[model samples]
Target: MTSTALPRPPIKGSRTQPIVAGLVTSLVGYTSSFAVVLTGLKAVGASDAQAASGLFALTIAMAICAVGLAWFTKRPITIAWSTPGAALLAGAAAVNFGWSEAVGAFIMTGVLIAATGAIPWLGRLLAAIPVSLAQAMLAGVLLQLCLAPFVALSTIPVYVAPVIVVWLIFLRLSPRWAVPAAMAAALGIAGFAMGQAGTTFLVGELLPTLHVTAPVFSLEAFMAITLPLFVVTMASQNVPGVAVLASFGYKTPWRASMISTGIGSSVAALFGGHAINLAAISAALAAGHEAGEDRSRRWIAAVSSGIFYILLGLASTAITALASASPTGLLEAAAGLALLGTLGAAASSALSDPTSRMSSLVAFLIAGSGLSFAGIGGAFWALLAGLAVRFVIERKRH
Candidate 1:
């Protein structure tokens, strides 16, 4: 008799469950992040394709780690394009260097992140930070993205405002179907209006294009991008990402999460991606929802995301088409609306206690100010400002 044993089937549920959940959540989180990253690239004078390439690098790397880890763990441990990393990238690009320099820095940051992940001490240090403070920082980091749709409404009133209203209504009435329904509605309205206006929106007919740049070593770029990326990514993305996994009752090693993210980031950096990190908020959704009562089924979701992301990286033209095919108003509104819960939770925790109130406010303002220095971004400044306030307060008390 043959002695080989086939792997057990995943707990009862469709294998596609996690995949759909991962894609949906990723779409919600990445759209705003992509907008910011692409805008930053433009600010630094990168061409459209290069900017898109950056996004492509990030998503593909994340897909690999997220999918691979999930498959190994038999759990739905989803990773994503690091929003905090993207924010850091925008600042680094604007101040310290151009796309080339940013790429150099990205590789360096990935190394540091990997090292941090490999070292248990750093992981403990990260966890030692007060949970409330972590939540506050997470809130601060997400605030800008959460507000973008409303901000867009001021300029693109007809296009964005209606979608926001309908999304809000759906959010109240049917939370489960809210996102997809709002998305469908937005597209339908936009299509009808465009048709009446005698315009058509269609994906372009173009073959996939690939361009890979070898890494360049730039000390200046490395100095500027490294610390800020390390700080923001750990504080804003990894902290929350780990927290989400914990909240969902998975006890994956912090070292493992960090290592995966670090490796993913490094791999992507080699290909000109910005940075990669563990996802926090959206990950919770994928891990918690109907994908599987058993965590293993969720692994399938992450693997699917990885596959989709590979397609995205290789088929840049197709990726853009998929993103562009959606109505602008719909994408904007849906992203903002989806983040409502996470945003509220962040604000509540940040403002909850009187003891750390001042420090939290400092953190909030600096992060929200959108400041940049020597190619680093605001999240670093905010944390520094908050730590400064905390130190001062403690010093005065002593």
Candidate 2:
């Protein structure tokens, strides 16, 4: 007698791995860069409460935008706080603009970002920027942060060595887990240090508080802070972010992403946060094959990341306390480790083409120099220099 063969069981899709990757990616992205945001806010005259509130608001806003956009487009569209813009704010803080004016500048920058999506000419102008120049500028912006690991090693070897060791091992065994492992190492070290000092590692109001700052606009703030912020967010953050998705074969809706981030940034500014934009480095984590084997299901990664971000925002007070308790060099080391891959990718992309080599190098050096002119940051100057060089040199060949 022949026995009838039972039909094969359907394979169930395993979402656990992708979801975990998303959560870890979100946590690393936020923790690695939140220090920069806080420092920038304080530099611009925000009180401790205001700075913490700003972090909470920014995280919540970006979480909403990331989830909404990823669901709408069915793509892993990750949104992030503008780390370069925060760095720009840190530099502009020395210019004496108060927190109110900084908030006003944030509003204006958001308006400009939104306009880029609505206005065809503006969008085209941004899109026309050379890839090499944009990547060079990003490399320049990330250079200082990426050097923090080395500096931390020199300053606090005991705290940094374990972090570096763990990061290196994980990077070799499982590259995706490297940054998270490094972050955990840092937290452990910080906790031990706090214990030695007789201080609590996590002590703060668990609830997030909202603090609204009335924006007061001025030409100085606009020129020095707002315009530069708009330029950098668009060039260094949004442009590369779109490119990252495209590299992973995702057809991103550029206008929609820009508009959503613009609105999110505007809302965040009311509570003292700066611009929110597309995630460049972290986008790869959510959009790549690691998220899921089925491309259509990868949006889940972004959605999960958004959920994690909201939870983090709700715990902003505790996060702020933890950050304050950590050694300065330790936090910097974690951030630096997180960004090492990004720095390498940017450098390679910026110098990839022989034709744009000279112009790209010029942009990189000028942007890395941290020079300022008439309230404008070095990023804008670098772009201008790169464009001028490209025109003069490339035109002659034609």
Candidate 3:
């Protein structure tokens, strides 16, 4: 009979394993969520060209930041665009935050991130915000995007079903690539549809350019976009990223990392991007043993991924063009698949503690309800409502 024992691994990791892992890390990171970023930016009033520029800017900024951090610390500290923050933007865009106002909000978020590192008490304040509410808000913001697949399936099954089927097949076979595979399927369909439509592309359309906008700040945008974005990025990406790396026996340079990402975010905002932050998912990919057995040398994986990011970024315009041509709901279906895991995690966290369950539920409902008042978005109101409910209930019990 054939033995069922697992094969032994090499005593020392292969020199090339880290390189391969790095490539996979970037591939997964970019393919998995670029749709979300594009959708979010466009929902907030960005034109097709502007949205492409935003994606390119974010990709390049994260690449530079990741490379710099990994090279300096010799640790696999990955950087990424704020995926959750982008979703939050998607949800908030309904409030009609003009593109210029959104750009200003992005700058404000960048400043807040930098302040968290430069000012100690500020970080503490942000950390002190209840995790339950933060998670609840995130879940709520993701509600519509996550439901997009089923909606698309109902309305446009002819186009979206194949994408979902491919996603399901990959989800079972290789969960890491499920969303990317779905994205690929969607892209193929989009490209074919484009061919049928005889879409023409010029050489300039293939290259990305910056869509610089002078930021126009306002209190409404700050309250509606900036605070919620910063909170989501920090609670969901930065803090968890640090914890993720710490689990792998590496300490992230918190201040430096924050400052670098903050500056990168600000610069990218001027060019139509939202935010960048420490990476949670990609961080694990490069820091894990799969990257290399020699922990000290795993930083190379992060650097490799950063290099890949730069190259992938160059293709943003072409990719955006393909996405722009996709049949209605196709990109949404793809984005919804990409966000399923995140929605599940956020929902679970939001309801984990019984004490805060009702409060979090309040937040969840309010945010998802798309409630808006005084020209502010549902997410901001949701947080306030949740906090108020928590306070009232807790005080009475105390």
Candidate number of the best lDDT: 3
C-alpha TM-score for every candidate: 0.75, 0.84, 0.96
Which 10 successive residues of model 2 have the least lDDT summed? 9-18
Residues 76-192, model 3: lDDT tens digits = 988999999999988876675699999999999999999999999999999778998999999999999999999998898988999999999998999998999999999999999
lDDT of 1 by residue, 258-316 (tens): 77788778777655666777777667767786565666466676666667666645645
Q: Which has the better lDDT: candidate 1, or candidate 2?
A: 2
Span of 10 residues, lowest total lDDT, candidate 3? 9-18
Candidate 1 residue-wise lDDT at 182: 57
Quote the positional error of residue 185 for candidate 2 in Å: 2.4
lDDT of 2 by residue, 1-398 (tens): 89999997643454675687689769877866776787667667888778889999999988999999999899999899998777656545446567898899899989899989988898888777877887787677667767878988888888888999999999999876787778778877877777788986324364689899999998878876776688778877898898999999998797898788898898899998999999988898898877866777888889999999988888776666665678877776777777677678778989999888889999888877777777566666777888899999965764
Clash-forming residue pairs, model 1: 18-301, 19-301, 74-296, 92-375, 241-280
Worst 10-residue lDDT window, candidate 1: 201-210
State each model's CA lDDT, in order.
0.64, 0.81, 0.92
Off by over 4 Å in 3: 1-13, 395-398
User: After best superposition, candidate 2 residue 15: deviation in angstroms?
Assistant: 6.4
Query: TM-score of the candidate numbered 2?
Result: 0.84
